[model samples]
Target: MSDLSPTEVVEIEICRRPIFVVGSQRSGTTILASSLRHHGALWYSTEGYILNEIFGPERLDETYAVARLNLNRWLAREGVTREEFLERMGLGFNVLLSSRSGGKRWIEKTPENSLMIEVLGTMFPGACFIHILRDGRGAVNSMVNKRTAPGWVTDITWACRAWRRYVDAALEYAASHPDRCLTVRYEELVADPEEGFEAIYQFIGVPYDRAPMDFFRTHRTSSSFRRRIRSRSSHEALADLWDVWPLQFKRIFLEDAGVAMLRYGMVSEEEMQQMVEDARDPSDESPSWTEELEGYRSRRDLAAVVERGVPRDAVMLVVSKGDERLLELGDREAWHFPRDEDGGHPGYHPADSEEAIARLEWLRARGAEYLVFPEGSLWWLEHYTGFRDHLAARYPRVVDELDKCMIYGLQSVRQVPTA
Candidate 1:
């Protein structure tokens, strides 16, 4: 700090390729960036705006002229050409990042970075960009629901256009620099994270490690926001919302995002036409079902049920459907039902009641003291009748409320005949 000028400090050669994770807001960019932050070789920051601030298109011609004149004067006084100034700025960014990166490569994430891909590519020629794309409907729905900031887009048309704009910008950049950029779909990544993250690591020229995949287990994003709007399964929730949106909203979304959706294979022409027709004559316009869906999504009462009913220090197996919210509700230890060998969520329900019973016995044998079925997963009781009967005939019900959850005390196993 005492020995060198800012210019002198920024002269260090940049040796590593920085990773830029760019995507539309609410397109899983935060989750992706948070996961990558767990990688030992990468240092991730919330958002980097310097590049965009310096290179973004000016909104007003007068402001642009004044800014350019002042910038040129400063550059002339500093005795550096514009290109040299840019090079040093890039190096300076790297130096600052490297300081906190602990000698590892650095990663930056910002939804707005989707629009600054060309500038980023020019500044860091060796940079790797991961463009995460989500289904436009889901992205727009989330954007409209979670209008967290004052200037955030809330209208259907504006949200749809914004999502398409970011997606098109990133995809356009990826098309030209295929070697340096990779586009990852949010749905595919959620479905099979191992394959997705493996490809990501390979593209970024880093050794693949399984630790980063555990980020979902360790990280919780906006629990309050999630409790308000998110469902146990985002894919299913989005599908339900799409089915219920009015005809006008659907047309607006399609007009702004239809082509991009087709490009991603999210919807075909036949399906798009079918969706439009279906929206025109929705079978159920009653608000009751929508309210029920929202109630199911919220899980507000379920949290209270878990916190109040589940005993402290009990090892519980929860039929969570990959939602991690319940995992944080109590002091007890919780594991997803039908969990993998590593205790991670299996991401799907058992194929049959027999399999469900087998998984239950497996977890019980491994010291699972209680079994929980949250409100969202109560369908398992009806769907897996044999498993439900076995539990009812054997383990005593510790907590059962129609609107909340069902908990079975698994202190002792009894040989009960299945129906």
Candidate 2:
């Protein structure tokens, strides 16, 4: 991509003053974005294809790194520079929505945006961010029930982990950019739409009005979509986690979810303590052992928590050692690097040179188009650092890295000279 004149870039930037709405999947981001889109002063997109051009399929796992790669490609493809690309991508909705928004500020929301705050920040220096957070357990149940949870999302354990990631990112950015950011909780947002949206409006420096909230309530032409998203009493949702999620993930809910829960005030200390006590492994006599999982925790470690069957076991690939024990698969082949009896995991990643070659070979042989690496395996991606570079190098071939997982397209990747 060639650099553009500074004046041209600045002109494009001037045309773009956008707001981004982001949060975990099933966290009410869609409804909030939908409501905001109706504003006469704004236009928003539910699933803008331009984002796919910007960052493959919204690889939230390593958003910034991968987006940087795609941003350059997007710039070249659009015949724009970094600044021009930012302006074009950030405000492209104006053109998509055409005259509907009357050239007002555009809004875009994708669950992966939560993890891409820094990347978006770089794109639109002065843009506002509205982050919606849902209770970890509530989000887990809603996400799992969907079954079509994004590729970046794996299961209950990773669901909670992914939520914590987004909330933590929102909170961190809010701290640094207090004037530019707002955090809204899904439960509270639905409980009081007027109040929730008012806070959002004020945070965006727009006049507070109840009309947008009313529009959201009245614009439900599809009862099913509305019902799927409408706020409901979810106090019983916590109990559903126990029956739905595996044991290891329950421990993650007890151990790893605390920092964000406490920081965001999602759960009280007393309630969290009770949850921890209830989720304690019976074999471990030490009650406080969960804290030991703090620093060195890995996706593989959390995955090792399942000792019994979990619902929705017929997945593409089970990430843990207890697949045979916890998964009720009949004839489906589970992909892993062939484990040994001692319970050690396979030390293979598609990133490894030789491994990438062999992995692509095996996948092609099976006529597979896509391969899923559960979010659990890549939760703390830096723990396995070069992972993003590996996928980013594969570009459009890698496809998606959102919904808590990495999906590789075998045909596209196979064409990449075995990266």
Candidate 3:
């Protein structure tokens, strides 16, 4: 001890307060957490279910009397007072999270955490929460389509009720703890991601960084449902799903979720009543919604080919037809076909096969190592025979799944002289 210097002494500071992201399932929580993970000052771990098991009570009341009663019995057995038990538990939790935080603020995201905000607040007094609120129609639609396993709500009526319950509880907490909680709307976040994320950064006391705005390019979300819904625009997809609902299901949704929907500005009272009227005159003709959805799902199957065939860090030019979702599939660098001079979407296709071939060569010269054609863009091969032939003659085909996609390796191809 006499020989020890100040530099030799080790001091460990526990992180008692961490950021939490909470929401109803399929309400943009995953994407929000994924984006926040990119922040240099933050570390986001997978959902922490352990917190709920340990701290969350069966019934959450304003007084928390039931939780206190249960904890007090356990505290007595440990020979500690309530204050001492909480101090130790808080320290242990901080130690566990800090061990993996990489010396940055930690974030925990679990949809179920939306119900445990009050409990978590008591456990970590300084903890901040972000609640992502989605339109109940969109959230319930996704929930019904995905059909998550093991006790997840699958019925449309139950799904609507679940969404309303989560939203109502979170909003109630936010009303009392305005400084500690922030509520973000999913539609607004996607409409202007940069502005939305900037506000989030400010609220979390972190420096704003633009990297999070490009999360779609960097983070890969499990999006099979998203792929199926790609047959139409998001608005069209939601409208189609709503129109197909039976009269009873429509009434159930309106009864269970209509008020929360209005509170969140998702729909006006007039629109809600209009839905009720629309449900009465059910059309006899069925829409081809299922077939259209499956068609797009099959078209996106090419994403698997890209993930397996393309090398990591290689540059790929995908015939996406302006769909950025394809670019998020693999670990490779991808750009849209027919990109402009600045490497952005050109907003139009090539004028002819000659223009297409010219653009192909230009992109290749700029380090594009592969060209991929998913089924959705296979028409390009039929429409631009010259460009197709150019690729076939010069580049070796790496993947040739007939109904999925075709991949052409461009890195080592010898350019054939123009005829």
Candidate 4:
């Protein structure tokens, strides 16, 4: 418990000049945050989760709700001023970040923050926001490559459409409160980070410096994590980033990220037609539905934890011996534990008791950030006397989900204060 009383805690301001980076998912928010973290005046989050950590993701729902009754109960228990409760509940995290800040303000990035203008604005009055805009094609392609797109988002057309909707809502919110928001295009940022970052610093009311542009060389990060966040090669900036989406979306490359994407809020008819033409008209042999579904599920498991933002050195414990094979394609695998010739399957469930709590702690002791039960392969262990649920009941969290195949993080359960 805080030594400070509840009233005093409510009065205390935790973060001054909070900065949030928001935009469509996969729109370079992470890269932007990683680079900005190099600045002397900013402490970017390693836990890449946004304000929701303080608000909620405490349950699994696409719409992000636990229950109306639960919300009311929390409101009653914590007191009516949600902001005060939020600040107090979040005090530990704030203290931790402040220690990490080097006297700088905190800069938080979570693509989902794009939908959270009003809540964020309320939480941190006059806080600055940087919204990074990527061309829809590039964003879609990247989502497919990273497999972070939500389950319903199937192909390039749907992906682009989803981008259009999200970008519209986020930018509209930003426009409503112009002084606090700055929208930067991804192409421009990667093309000339020094100038781009200068504009960013100016918008966020910080001194422009050369540190961020040289982040890769100067900043401290693991070799693998360093390798992952490295800025894109200018050479790869071909017209627009293009890779052929197999089957449905075909070879849709937006060398310029397409002019149409820029007009998401006020798209002209001609631009819409051009975008449709770009995504379709030609097709390759589509992968079977089973193949696509499996791939989606595989990536879904990965994204559940990775999207939460993790320390560069976080280590994932893959439950299956050969499950690591699926990691070949994407750069997010930087979070994977070092290939332990010693670490593979756990061999077998405990003979003493089927309960997995002891096993979980054992894995945590061995430096596991998350435990992946790929494709429900660990059903025997998880289903043992509702072991997953038993642990979840004791340690409720945003990541406290009971899925047959999911990435259950050891760090996740610890987010809640024991008291």
| Alpha-carbon RMSD to native, per candidate | 20.6, 18.0, 20.7, 20.8
Writing each residue's lDDT as its tens digit, candidate 1 over 1-419 gives: 48756674334545469899999988888888888988888888677776666656332233334545774666445665544545555676777787777778888888887886776675676788999998888788778777474455778888898898899899988988899899998878876788999999999998987878788445635422244235546566565677767777776775677656755678765766566556443654542323432443346567678778877878988888877766655467888887888889888889999999999988888999988888778899999999989898889998989777899999986777668
Could you tell me the TM-score of candidate 4? 0.48
C-alpha TM-score for every candidate: 0.57, 0.53, 0.57, 0.48
In terms of lDDT, model 1 sits at 0.76
Candidate 1 regions off by >4 Å?
1-15, 57-85, 217-237, 279-419
- Cα lDDT tens digits for candidate 2, 347-385: 544444455545444544654433445545444245434
lDDT of 3 by residue, 1-419 (tens): 48766686556666755898988988989889878888898888787787766756333332344445665665444565544444455566777888889888889888888877776676677788999998888888778767454445668778998898888788878988999899998767866788889889889899978777798345635543354454665555566667777777776676677656655767755775566566453563332332333443554477667778888889999888787766765468999998888877888889998999999999999999999888878899899988888888889999998789888999987667888
What would the TM-score be for candidate 2 when compared with the true structure? 0.53
Error of 2 at 324 (Å): 39
Q: Per-residue alpha-carbon lDDT of model 4 for 305-331, expressed as tens digits? A: 545643445566555544555443233
Candidate 3 residue-pair clash tally: 0
TM-score of 3: 0.57
Worst 10 residues of 2 by lDDT: 306-315
Clashes of 1: 0
Winner by TM-score between candidate 4 and candidate 2 = 2
